[model samples]
Target: MLSPRESATRERVSLDGLWRFALDPEGRGRSERWWTDELPGDVEVPVPASFNAVLPGRESHDHIGDVWYQRVVRVPRGWDGERIVLRLDAATHRAVVWVSDTQVAEHEGGYTPFEADISEQVRAGEPVRVTVVVNTELHWDSIPPGFVQELEDGRLLQQYFQDFFNYAGLNRSVWLYVTPRTHVDDVTVATTGIDGDTGTIDYRVAVAGDGGHPVRVVVRDAGGAEVARADGAEGTVRIEGVQPWRPGAGYLYTLEVAVLGADGEVVDVYPQPFGVRTVAVDGTRFLINGEPFYFTGFGKHEDFPVHGRGFDPAAMVHDFHLLRWIGANSFRTSHYPYDEAFLDYADRHGVVVMDETAAVGLNLDTGAGVLNQAGPMETYSDSTIDARTQETHRQAIRELIARDKNHPCVVLWSIANEPDTVSPAARPYFEPLVAETRRLDPTRPVAFANFLKATPDLDVISDLFDVLLLNRYYGWYVQTGDLVAAERLLEGELREWAERGKPIVMTEYGADTQPGLHSMLREPWSEEFQIDLLAMYHRVFDRIDAVVGEHIWNFADFATRAGISRVDGNKKGIFTRDRRPKSSAQALRQRWHGTEEPQPDTTRNVQQDPQQDLQGDVPQGVQQPARQA
Candidate 1:
């Protein structure tokens, strides 16, 4: 959705290194055409990784189905009347591209960015080739829906849909760019309305040919002057004393849309980088520009330790410098949608995101331990591929609210993660995915991610979210360590989600520590039972108050898929997975940035030093509770 930039005086071309990979697993590269040339025994491989964890065996990263990359390019001469494209920054569950054999484009949701234009199959001076052909395979109408098995000496494995580690190849980065054939295309921006000291913003552009020019938006502020300026293409700019983009205190504003012409010059700009601010929610508080914002970090995972989910910009600025050294602010890409340089470093280092959507494993009659309140409850799948998986989950929630409704650290949009909202077939698949996400971007707040079988007398879909992202696990997966029965089942599920008045975000509570696991009394995969399950889910999110926020289910520790309840992965990561830390990251830097907490080890024995129980991190015939704490 309009996010393949490079027009600051256009002209791109950085097809990011190696190519010519292979695989096809007998799909035989479009039945032996292989994009009409080259790629016979393919090899090189590396444009943005995951080629099965940067190769080292298994025919270069466990062969799935349909693969084959290629590459050759050339064109550049004078681009021959403009408009090139080919972008591709990711190519997971499906792609098609081809240039020499002509195909054009075929994409089908693979984490985002996709383009093709290629101006009538290139050849301005030679080489061309291209070819792509991905296809990591997913099913029941895919949107994260997966499960491909097949063994018996034939090998094909992939089981399990969500919880990370599927890492297919061509994970990101691949350009060619060069626009201007009557360019501009799209550029939303929203903030609209701030008051007290003036704010607004609004703007919207989308030029691509059709009667020449007249766009012009421009707003600049982080010191490059320009203040406010508008000419058409869509109004409102406002400005005044408005700096607001605060979380850890951060600000940014510098639009510059343009299109001008008719002798006004600047024929195609499109700079976009907004952040005027406004995240509203009101009822049970979660405002932003209106204040009340509380959402301490993690539900994350684009995962790493070998570029599994690829795109590591120095591990994305060290996970936003360890979520501002554990004081946290917000995070929740969990279940999908990440990388656009991690929302441009949460729009210049402020934080707060949410933005989900790989609509995770949409239930489908649950399998294995799938939300087993002892199974037989699993629902969601009304057939016809669940109506083509709810139309690819409403086109991945309108492409994650059109590629993250103009950032300001994307407040919230979620969609589905931990779905099967306690079936009646999940209210016709989440009532049209919450009416196609409030008809795509009703400006922030649209939540989802509520597992723990959405209780409260068997869920009513958390009264259709505006916020109530509960992914509860009570002392870890249902009273596993039994902190007084996980605080009376989280005070009866936070008083039934604070009596449904909204705002409740405890999106996934943690408990999976293995980094130097220890236990004198604190058991379950101890790093002291993941620091006593985040100080008992932060003392029940500080005694309700509509339980505002918590996050913690992962800030680090990723790479899941060696089973036996994940040992080499999904160690609920409060760091470790190479990001280190994990003594519950020093008890969340002492319950979020107040620091100095780690003490209790005065030679062990809080109740007879014996490694309490729940040996392999309970959850599945759940037992282990020698009762200690």
Candidate 2:
């Protein structure tokens, strides 16, 4: 689906409609033998929305192996001469595409876009049927090994259970493209640099057409006047002194790539809108347009409440609204990279992104207490991390950067999340990896989460990363005596590190929440307590002058299997996992962006109000102690 705000250049055959699903993989080819759902039955799941949320008996349902989705469409006679293509904005980990029993394409990864050229497979003026078979089970032979678990029934399930739920099937858009043989394959515009008055743009165009066909490239400002034009073999074209795109102010430019036939007839044209902002990391300082800015954002997960990780543009837009409303200026793609459209939306909507690689929760022996445990007395060093895991980390980072570098909103390249350096060899593992990132794109700063105090190896590794991000969960992890004491100790330590003149970013901080489930507002675990803790940090931000920025642990609550008692999981989010705003969220809205407005007096009122009437409903003898927040 294209943007509702703007019309698309190509009037696509609205292919995202009600479709049928057949259970049989073999019958996918046979036309009529397949099971067809009555119109408006459970078979037709909304495109870009999670199918797992709508399947029969889907409420809190668990495991599934395979499923089939079939859609029938009557081809327009006018589209007979043009090549028809089927585009799946996203599918699960693995899926095979069949149009009328003819297998056309297969795709891997539940996060990226894939296309199947069904031009030759579909018959014009006939009811064309497209079938998609999806497998959500994790196969060990795949690139990133999936997880396996034994259920209570003694049945083993092989699948990945990350922090968020994995919504299976085709969740993104299904578009049909009627294109001429000579069409634009891809068009990427790189904003090299932007000075005070002028912006520099480098256009890298990839096209598929008759060899030697001339292509015309045009750059237009938001007003639609052609500012720069280039005609060539559709290679790299550089345009200088163009207006630059800035954040918050919503400045955007349009780059049009037109494929011209011998007769100069416009065969196919692709227009991409981009912002040309200069992003840089100076030591530990993050800058856009040469101005230093603090990153106030959340660590966002890809999963939605019901859809799992499926694509819902509207749902994503709603997420963005919450982010903006909360006055967050940035977001970290925690644990894994998100859908491309999410990043694209961030670009235009003025939200900074820490485009992270999908490497998290590895190397650390969760069973151990120490930071790194390679030897009896040994601590974390470079060597303790797994050798096999290093390659997987590199591959995920490479793919993430290669795909997301063009986004202006992406300022930091988060190499990994909460990964441990269990051995001494781990230093060498990271040294070369960070160096390679610089080699790939030295434009953005490289950063990862740092374990505090436990390991001196952090200082050794700090040189490799541009920004040293620390995730301190002092209030939750180690009781550390008292909140004030812990905050003081952390502040002193941070000051000592800042005295080293190293750049620092507090990557994560916040207590868990049970969403309206707290015993005392004064205790650190309470929602009110978490709010007060963050409020204290607002003051610390000024004290730790060297700290360039900080992103709260998360914007909203997310699912985590490794949770603690009372809540069953970490309830650290300021908002509920379901995206409901907590009373503490209001406290943030006031102090966010350094606003001086007086925060609403919710603390006194909430504390004074009688405990909510969730009492008698408590299970048989289970005392409803205030949950964990």
Candidate 3:
């Protein structure tokens, strides 16, 4: 793993542009020996994007086999004698890389960055051919797992157990970086504690090529003033008068880890920005730096049109702006880990993130495959929690923790989203994963998104977490449009969770609101209904002090497989897929952003009209009812 950016000591060249692409659906590319050179059909496609959504034809959009990408990169002359590495930011599912005739690297996970050492493979100032084979197919062992259904007509359909489109490609950037022989391999920084005027930071560094190399660590405050310095790989640095990072006041300290070679020259440097804050679970409260903290945001997806889950900075910026506009302060990367720069922005902007793994919908055959599954899916088969999938999930979590442990924005580590938690088999599957996370990093709280179901006897895995994340859909999916009963059921469940003596966060709660659709009768799929339902859930959330946060089901509408239940994808987003505000945004602004407290009748069935009372701010596309026509 490397820093998100490059410096003089650790230099990198971006290989993010058009690349030669070829589809190998027949899986003959390996047998035909396409690894040595380019494949036959010559089609140039953009790097940092999924070939699925950019190309024409339904075949390319749903191609689910070995896809090849070829690009020629020139080794920089300045990188001579240095440890040259080729890094793929992200490739879906699995990827194998070959530098010309030499097979360099193979990585299994898709959401994290992986690199291959190519120091001896290429000559300085010469061009080298790089080939990447990405497998987009899914199986029982895959996280956010899915299966392909062979129809009776010989037509294959990709059906994901998860609710998002299966966007596959080198959907993130590629880079060729150069570092000294003995580099700063790994950096782990943990916030120990914060007393009145001093804050403690515990940090460690792993040098790559050589051991016993002198390591130096330095920390600079937000104003670029050096506050503390320390030596040794594992030691603590105490900064006097340290400022704690809080919501809307994201104070970050830059920690630089540097290694020195035998010549006493700086070989490599890794800079990481961290916040000085501690998170702990006490009694029934989730505390951030020793005070009760509440999380109010959305369970978001890195999805949109054209790019199809590809990393788009402009879109991400717009989404963050809209989130701030809607009075949201946090979000959970539901189902998968997002790009690195996303968390960097979250750290800068003070948005707390429940950093979740890509291990979603692991419960096979059951409708739990779908988010907020819309049926009776009580029977949790053993196949869902098999040994192979468990091991894969464990690896994903380790990589996630190792990658994101430094971010102050990440206050909670969510192991999975909407998994089969109610089954008897889930206990053995989830217990070890949560235990391992706590073992790996005890700084943050560990929790998983739990679906509302199963009896107390069947659902027995709630004790493993530092907090409780309940994904209940009382108004939207339970009663199908009734917020009143949804309120009662939501309250009762919150009561049960409060009895556990742990903080409860409503991780998933929202209604589907079509962007242009509006209704006066408060019907389903209307913006008003979305606002009404959220208001009800927020009422119960405010009443119960044990409830610490409420992350709405989604921040924006995202692409999903074509199904009867999903209307052009799940419409539960408070904002449209294009980042336009729904009525819920205006309502949430009043409830969260405008005032410290919003006064409303939580027990009332009908909500107040936004046209008159919402401080002259009307919901997007809301229409005033006609006067007696």
Candidate 4:
């Protein structure tokens, strides 16, 4: 899963930009042999974008089933003998690739990279047709599972339990990269020990193809000066006066791994940037580099108006700047792993991340209006989510760790976001997944965001994780428009969780607010209500000793499935959908940076009625569903 880069013995070319696009609502693209010839439609779509938003009409925006993308690429003249790989950064849901008429590769996951060895299909210095068919369908066995229902009008409707809209297609980049036949396949680096001013780094290099090549490793500091060197496939290098990577102050060492030929010339080289930091959970504290760290950020989604879930570089940079502006330190890639570029930026800026798998929507009972309702059907049974779903979940965890384990910004591995941990069946289902995550990379702690239903008393699987991540909605979903009652309930729950003696992180807690809406009273959907709700949650967090982090439910308003619950989309963002700061954002900035707080309005005397029922005023049970990838 190493990102493609150019080296002395490597080359990379982007297979992005315009590609021939066609929609096959009846799933007839493959059977029609669309790869052998030009598509029937004359439409063109951009790669590294969700086809959903780029196409015209509402039919295209809400397309279901299969879509085809075809393009012609010229193989580099120098890549005659090298191993050429056609890597797709991501192909939503499922994808099948073909070189002209011959099928080459197939992949299932939508959030991780997959590649096909196209050296055999295309000759060097020649143009070859590359066709890809992407399917936007999910089943009970798929990660972030969904279903398709046929309407009376003979149109298929894609439905999912997850709160976010299912934006599908090539949402990331595609690349054609070359490496030596005997090249570096993977590299893993770990900070073994840190004693005073000295630090120890252990590294292992995996090489592919048949070659007994001598492996060389060199570590260079920020000034490009050699700090440490080691020979062979695996070894430890020590550095005196080591600079530890810390929050808001990042330091990186570049580990250049090279394989040498028989004549002592370089055969292949791959440079990996890593930071020397360690993460641990000590009693009721989450520690980074052995120092207790508190997280303050948001649970973000890769969403926008036009791009949908597509990757936008400018937006990414702006987001990191906003994180700094707000004086926040971390964010959870809420329900799925984000693009590698984000993690690279985090490494340079020192923003911690809770890397999560795409195992959202594991609970069968959660939907738009269902919060605390549990059905007779089991989420883990064969008739429902089942064992196949768990396998996909396990693979997602494996790929997530394999791709992100080397990044210092990722301090914790969240296996799932708000799954059915309240059910007895959840224990056996999640036990192996948690163990699998730790087994893959024991360097970091493991956790899953606890659903509101899986409270401190009912949860059966919190002990399996190192940290307890709670996504609570007190003032919003639970005690609507009642800040006093919400505070008491939130505090009572924190007290119950305190008995477990594990570090508790409120991964999500926020209220939806219309930007222009204002009210003297603490009314839901108003700017004042959002600020008041956050202040109440902050108060409870300060009183609890185990509370280590607070990431708001959203960074900005994101699109969700059309329903009565949504007014355009989710408005829980402290900032508007366009990134304009709402009143709550400034309030948070003041609180997190220890500045003067915004004074409450005391001109009007507001009557308090604890017995008031405000349920009818707000959207009934209109809360975010448990997360999925």
Candidate 5:
């Protein structure tokens, strides 16, 4: 076993360690003390994941846009000319980093990692303060317009109406790193084409501060046997004649890129683990390692109950175990990007990930009109703002791709989910965005979640992307009352796409059911209904060609403001947001992964008994919806 010190040395600092302060740009955080000092007092705001769940008074503070966070940390000693950097693993919307009151970097987009090298600004030996201000305010140019607080009838109303908790604040880890000046800035290794008999490996290494040194790349199999090695200036290499990475038979390799000085001593190095696996979507078919593979996973949001996005490493490991134990091989990073820790774990574990952009479907402009209030065939235009909106959309995509493109686990790049068709601005934003992603990473496919009734605008640009994904809540969103109707709708759509020779991924499925809740008649919200719905979806998928995968709408019940009965929102998760496994979660695991079946007692629905259930019921905090629509 490795000693803690050795483990710590090898383990990258949790991106969550940096200083955090909550204040407005005008100076709300400058005060030495805050108003409330409760255990999780006014100053002790809950991180977004469990924030609202804990702070009832602050529930009204949840909005779409920015809030401010400032934290101070003592500089670690024994450092010389090392980079004193600040990294936010995942921050919603926009982030600005500062060290000792000096601004170093500004990044947009909430999902990917953003860094600022504060080496020159910080004092070498003295303790220095690093502060980060994350603006969750609305900018049409930014994704997910920031927070808005509405007032109604002598009460304050803040609506963060989304599928998941707007777990803002520094949800992912924050960290500081000390690195050699001349180092391998980045290393990208891709398993481009994999066949039973032949395979290809391509890599790109970004080297900086090497003092005119040449970089060397070494490819090693799992046993540390050198498979291929080469030299390059900017750090690029290709390896052929390799065994392809395949699931159920974990085949992986390591690429070690070393930067050498003129005298040949190693100046800096970067090591990345990768698999030479060929993945493609052929006319609605997903081929991995030359085998037709089906996507059996859930749409996962990167938030937890206790820590929000500040995930404990054990929590991540626990999550992987749960996913495997339950029989899932894929997951969609629904709505935003996730921490690198999650991605790295996925890579080693062989889970297929449909890595998503920070963009979402709510960008649709309802013209202040409720969706149901609109007439049939109403002017279905993208409600998003014009050209400026497109630019922000582009930036979000670029940042996400640039940061995470190399991960073998990430097979698909989802551009946006359900950009509103009611606004004319939607298609213009999507088309060029898809084209640009293709230009950057042609090895992977680009797709968007078709949330609306209409065909997505970018579908015609099929040549640019490898797969077509549709987020259908047919059983929940469109035909909740009729399982047959849901099956028909799903089957019909898959058949149409198959005929077009377009590979399709049922990106979203599953119904919202309060755990343990059973219909006296085993109706829609019952455990039986949930199980039947999933099986029916599988049935529909079985009949279609090119239907490679099916992801249920949600992996767990997240934050929903509706405060409906036991489920605050729809309560569709297989596991509660708190990580409690639900009956449906077990049913899916049993059916798909051949996992053990849960006892009848374990499948008791939560909706009927909120206290006994895994605390999935609506708390008294959020105001109940006035007359469910």
Candidate 6:
């Protein structure tokens, strides 16, 4: 979705302070007409934050039903004839919005933006009561599926398979913006090609309303000097001596699109910042700008202490600074799409990203642990996660690509994380989703984070993707406390995957380490063990010719559900929850910043055989591994 912007023809106001909030455990807010009247026993909660962390008592932190947020807003008098819009950057799970007594919009899918044109709901200079109802319930039909159960004492319990806390409420910003009646609705910029000293950018501008008005596009450099111009809704602009955006060094060019009235007056303007970069996947090698690029970073989440999953500018800036200081160059949005403000920072700072959807925990069999006594379950059957769930997954893929397709730092699209791809039924379920991703945006490649249960020999859908993202936890999950056995098993698996001739990225591989817990000998849950486990994986990666990248399990510690497997929260982070560096942080800094030897170039002489095609029927009756979390 196009972000709300301010310009000569547009205006924006942030509704991001304190708002009256109350919990509706019985789900009676709608029946009682909470939109028309004031909320009962309301308390103040900050916008752009998760209410679960800031509220008091376990009853509020573990709330499993609907919540109400109410506030009053006055429309700007100067925005009389313009189209006024109320935009919510995100609302967890589901949301219904109303202005005074008129219901305006309802939306599903929590991680993307949604909006409503409220121009007709209220007068220009009048105050209107704005009410919002947000639901935190998850089901089999929702993305990142979960279930709500009731205990004998009548308290509701929320259960999910993913290893992260389900922080709910309005977790992003809200804005009131105005645009001209016929305004620039969307603009898409694509870097078509890069030749000797020139680069080509193709663009398409979509204008809303019945506007036969002329459209103009201009490209400007960092110094605000016009470099290229085009005079249509869709065309190409070429730049000579183009400065390419590279790793650790970024250069952004602003594309300003404007709609002009018949009287030669500007009606609306939108400036989009984009970088000129190209991403491709060759046999056994990932290429950025036609050169081999190795990914070195972590799979991160939008998490913090008090804010939960909320968007915090201070935390975001500090995380990026820490990434740069550690000599890392990329990260994957582990389970979902992050805030737009984080992507804007990545655009200017040149950090590669693997943009992902909220399709985590698709497998029902591998929920608890990987080595337990459980047989394979049919995860794609009609009774459980059925076609409705697949449709939700499809829509998530669509929205993710639509919102993030223009980002230059987003080099790859991760469709899901740790899905049940070993079952034969999974082949037909995910084949079209992968195809739909390519159909939407063919500029970048698509992948999914492979589960540990679906190994190289057993996975049925590994051949469908351009890149293979494996989330392995050998040292921690499997051969616990045995780095030698872990290294041996990891290398054996890597060799089996090398025959596929696809670029293999170790998307997740780390052990939980408690800060200040040290041992002279190798031991699990200690700082030394975490350091040694990573070093072992790096050794194996350098030996495998197809292994191209390594992103550790997490960048920092994060909250999860209460269980015996976790102490307070997952301690797999190289940095603590408060951004304090652990001992492993220095080890990673030494290895990545050239104090240690660089990884060998293993991309040479690795090509797929032309006769080997993965179009045949998937092998059946392969025994699945035991469960592991």
The candidate that wins on lDDT is 6
How close is every model to the real structure, measured as TM-score? 0.37, 0.80, 0.91, 0.93, 0.82, 0.93
TM-score of 2: 0.80
Query: What lDDT does model 1 reach?
Result: 0.75
lDDT of 4 by residue, 176-210 (tens): 99998899999999877778888898999999987
Give residue 166's error in model 5 in angstroms. 1.9
Off by over 4 Å in 6: 368-377, 596-629
Report how far residue 284 has shifted in candidate 1, in Å: 16
Candidate 5's TM-score reads 0.82
- lDDT, candidates in the order shown: 0.75, 0.63, 0.81, 0.85, 0.62, 0.86
Per-residue lDDT of 1-629 in model 2, one digit per residue for the tens?
A: 22211123354665675566534323332344232332223555655555665555633134455566777787767667666777776676578777775678886655555676677877667887677777665433322334455668986544432344445677667777666676776666667776666677667666675776677888777789887778863444444565554445446777777887789988777777777777766654567777766766677776666665666677788787777666667788876678788878877766778887755544334313332122232223333334544665565566566677767778788886654554455577688789878877777778887654434334456656777777776656655326776677677667766765556777888777667656653675567777777766656666766676667877777644333332443466777767788777777665553445444465566656544311111111011111122
Q: Whole-model lDDT for model 5 versus the true structure? A: 0.62
Q: Is candidate 2 or candidate 5 better by lDDT?
A: 2
lDDT of 5 at 425: 45
Q: Please give the ranking of all candidate structures by TM-score, highest first, separated by commas.
A: 4, 6, 3, 5, 2, 1
* Model 2, total clashes: 26
Candidate 2 lDDT (Cα, 0 to 1)? 0.63
Residue-level lDDT of model 3, residues 43-72, one tens digit each, is 988888878878988889879788999998
**Would you list the clashing residue pairs of candidate 6?**
369-627, 369-628, 370-626, 370-627, 370-628
Q: Mark the regions of model 4 whose C-alpha exceeds 4 Å error after superposition.
A: 368-377, 597-629
RMSD versus native structure for model 2: 8.9
RMSD of 3: 6.8
Task: Note each model's CA RMSD in angstroms.
Answer: 21.5, 8.9, 6.8, 8.2, 8.5, 9.6
Write one digit per residue (lDDT tens) for candidate 1, span 1-629: 66666656577777877888877777867877878888887478677877888777776466677888888878778777777888786688788888887888887877887787878778556778788888887766778876566767977776554666778767888888777788788888888778987898777888887575888877888887888898888888899987877776558987888787888988778678878888889998888787777777788787676668878688878777767766676788888787787887778767778888888767644543542122232345443237787888788788777777888888888888877676666776687788778876777778888778767678766676688887888877776887888888887778876887878878888888888869899889879888877887677677777777778888888886666777677788888877878777766755555536545677777578444311111111011112222
- The weakest ten consecutive residues by lDDT in model 1 span 616-625
